[model samples]
Target: MKNMTLERITEVCGGVYYGSEADKKKEIAGAVIDSRQVESGYLFIAVKGEKVDGHQFIPQVFEKGALAVLSEQELSEPAGPYIRVESTLGAMKKLAAYYRRSLDIKVVGITGSVGKTSTKEMIASVLSQKYNVLKTEGNFNNEIGLPLTIFKIREQHEVAVLEMGISEFGEMHRLAEMAYPDICVITNIGLCHLENLLTRDGILKAKTESFEHLTPEGTAVLNGDDDKLCEKKMVNGKPAVFYGIGKEAKLAKTEQGEKYLAEKEVYATDVEPVGLDGTKAVIHIGAESFAVTIPIAGEHNVYNALAAVCVAGKLGLSVDEMKRGIESVKTIGGRSNLIHKGGMTIIDDCYNANPVSMKASIDVLAAAPGRKIAVLGDMGELGENEQELHAMVGEHFEGKGIDALFAAGALSENLAQAVGKCSKETEVHYFKTKDELMEELLPYVKSGDTVLVKASHFMGFPEVVGQLTK
Candidate 1:
């Protein structure tokens, strides 16, 4: 909200200023798209969504003391000031990009097929040890959401950690334009969004677009363990910093600790303790060694923490600060988050799911203390191998010491059938809808049971999680 005057905003957005010259120089307190959140001197963006057209609420926003409105259509009602553009969404993105340029903060951009949000949280937590950091909230990693996250930045923030998620080609390009990060981290490329990005290579290409707008001297933190990501030649002629369990990586893992070579600047093999509760790893950067402990589950999180530690070290955070920050990082909602209520442990990971993440969640459930019950839903946008992938997850459930499985959606029916083929004693049930699943699951679940709820966002599995918790 600092130095966000109407005149400055107009200059930043390159918007046509059409209103009172007196008010043009007046500063805006904030920017918002929803009319209900508009405050005095706030700039409102009239977004035309599927269900509602924000232009209809322009007059209402003005009545609520909005300083100006960005709209595609000129309003019939008299408003204080308005910036007319072809698309309010595009204008909002442009203004956010311009606003980001004004900040002196160091931006860390994260992208991948899986673990982007987790890595963003890890990096933010690590950076927060030494700086006042602002990070992307919940699933706000898309084109529209990315701009909104950028707008949340205020004067006190010394660093910004942003998650860039893309389902199609060129989406990351737009997201990167808004971030222009000083450092970029790619978690790993996997089988996701295959409906549009037909192959893993296609996904890799889409996710790597974050480097397009990165600063010239920006560092690219990569996963050396991932087969698809490790074959990179060069990024803008600068070698990427590779961190994984492999010996060839710049940051490799060894028994003593992580090793880093000066010539390669590689992190070598190290003795890192990873558990279902968290990960404790020693990262050797040059002669100094930093130990980090992250408060998230899964072995994948260890790599996420390692990537964050690498970036934090580059930013000049001390060993103690890095350790404290990594330890302080907590799981984001609906993302490998463990919640206990009604004497039942619910792994509320219903935000989204894929083949890679599904297996990971199953591992987490296996590590839990009580009986493991998996409530899974369909994974969307997996182009050609959708059924096969679902069946594969079912196979994992069969052999992974799972007590029971409840699935939803047409795709999930394949999962249930697949699991039933392998283990008749392992209970597998399929639901056509969330309501049906919720109705049937209550009697099956008991106190002290560990339940894992997982699915793609469209599957609406979170509703079932809410039902279980309630």
Candidate 2:
């Protein structure tokens, strides 16, 4: 919004301007693809999707007081002014990249195989204690979503905690170019997005593409416990900041080319999981330490907290500030958010899942008091080894003292069989569809029972959580 005048937009996007000269120098209030989000003076970008074409809403957006529209197709005698580009999405990315260069904001670009959203929230919470922070909202971390998130940054925001997600190789590179992060954080290179990436190493290489766009003075914050990440000593001529739990001692010995020296280590100790309450830990950075409690209900959240500590430390925040930020952080829905309704406690982690996250959620459910039930579904984009991955998650539930397992989706049938073979006493139920599972879910769950609903986004397990919570 700084220098985003109509003339500047046309120049940056290389689009042909088709409107009055009076509006050429006018700066837009905001930009959006959705016509419903269009406000007075906002720029509407017309994108053609599979189900709907945004061009159809151009007339409606102008009536709603939109200042200008970015279109890929020609309009006949349209309202207001418009710019015609070869591709609206490509134009939007160019606009976002230009806008990012105009801002004096410190961006924390977060990406990994998993835990991207949770880590973004943690970093934002910690940074907000000292700076006016703008973080990515919801699952808007893709190419389109990342640009939209960048467009939301304003003059008042001091820092932008952007979550960069990808399923392919060059996607992160494009996102990172627009973000131009001052600090890059890779959560962990787990078994995710294997459909396109094929393997963990492939996933690591793809996720680290964000580093290519890191500013010269940028720092890389990595998870030391992760074998793939711990080996990274330096990035962009700057030593990486490594954080983890139970891996601090090894950090110093981790080989860095010819030298065996640790980068900057921020590790946690005395990690105590408080059942559904969350996790308590002592975070150490250099000679200082802070005793903190994360009220988000999972041991995996400790990694998220550690990532936050590493970032906050780099940003010159005090231990007390980090502790308060870590403690005050609240869970977003579908990422281990705790919900109480209909006489039952539901862990609605149904937003998305990989084998690692699925097992992590199971650990949370296993630790809860009373009857522990796991309602799981298929994990998408796992490539050819998807069955083995699903079965691996099922094996994690074995001997965890889980009361019952309700698995939906075809891939989860492998999960059901694996859990049954390993944990003979655990009641395993397989449903062909989530609707069928939902019908039986309510009857199986009793008062005071703790239920964990989890699956990949495509599984639509939120509806199952909805039924139970209702």
Candidate 3:
């Protein structure tokens, strides 16, 4: 929002100004796509959506004191002032990229098959200790969303921790071009968006596109434990800072086996899982060591902590500051948020699903101290073998000490069948719809049971979580 005048915006977006000469030099307070949020001196981007067209509300926005509108359609009669561009959406992105370059700030761009948002939250929490940080809110990690997020950055923000998610190739390239990150974090290349990416190797190629737009001296942080991510030798001629757990982690071994370690890499040693409460581990960054308790479950979170520690160290956060920051980290809704109600514990991980994330949530559900109930749904975008991938998750449920399984959607039936085949004693039920599952879910749930509700966002499993909590 700084140094943003109507004249500069018109030049940055490559639009012809059709407004009054007096308004050309006027500065805008902010920019938005939605007309309803328009205020005095605001710029409205007329985005065409499936349900409602933003152009139709231009008159209303201007009446409410909007300074100008970026429009694709030609207006017969002027409403205050407007800029004409070939495509409003394209102009919005171009404007965002221009604004990002105009600011003097460090950006940490995060992307992966899973845990992009969670890792972003962790890194932002850690970095907030020393800097005035600005982070992406909710699921704004795509082309349109990333630009909107960039527009939120004020001059006061010293660091921008952004999450970039892509379904196929070229998406990350466009997002990276806008962010032009100084630090790149690739959580892990896992099985996600396989319908577009094809395989894990394809995922790696798609995810690493963040390196394309990274600064010349940018640092690449990666997950070394992953077989595919470990193959990377260097990014932009700079050694990558790889963080992970287990023997494969370079820092724990104290000797770089592959020469992939950056000037600094991190690892967690003497790991101890404290049931569902969290994990206590000694995080090692280069030669320095700090013992901290990650207030989140799953071994996967230990990797998140290490990733945050990597960023915090680069930002000059001391061991004590990082420790307090990690302790302050909290879970986001529908992404491993632990809720307790009706004398039962619920793991609300139903925001989205894939083979890797489903298994990770199951690992967390396994630690519940009571009867383990897994309510899973179909994982979308798994390519042609989506059923097999769903069944693979079911296989993890069987013989893994799961007490019951409630599955919905067509693909979830495969999961139920596989779990039933594996665990004869574990109660397994398949529903054609979530409505049917909702009807019978309460009857089967007993007091002191640990219930995990998870599925792809399209599956609408959050409704089931709502029913249980109600």
lDDT of 2 by residue, 339-392 (tens): 998778999999999998998899999889988899999999999999999999
Per-model TM values vs. the true structure: 0.91, 0.96, 0.96
Which regions of candidate 2 fall more than 4 Å away from where they truly are? 247-264
Better of 1 and 2 by TM-score: 2
User: Candidate 3 — which residues are off by over 4 angstroms?
Assistant: 247-264
Error of 1 at 360 (Å): 0.5
Candidate 3 lDDT, 296-395, residue by residue in tens: 9989999999999988888789988899999899999999999999899999999999999999998888888989999988999999999898888988
Native-referenced Cα lDDT, model 2: 0.91
Q: Which candidate's lDDT is highest?
A: 2
Lowest summed lDDT window (length 10), candidate 3 = 254-263
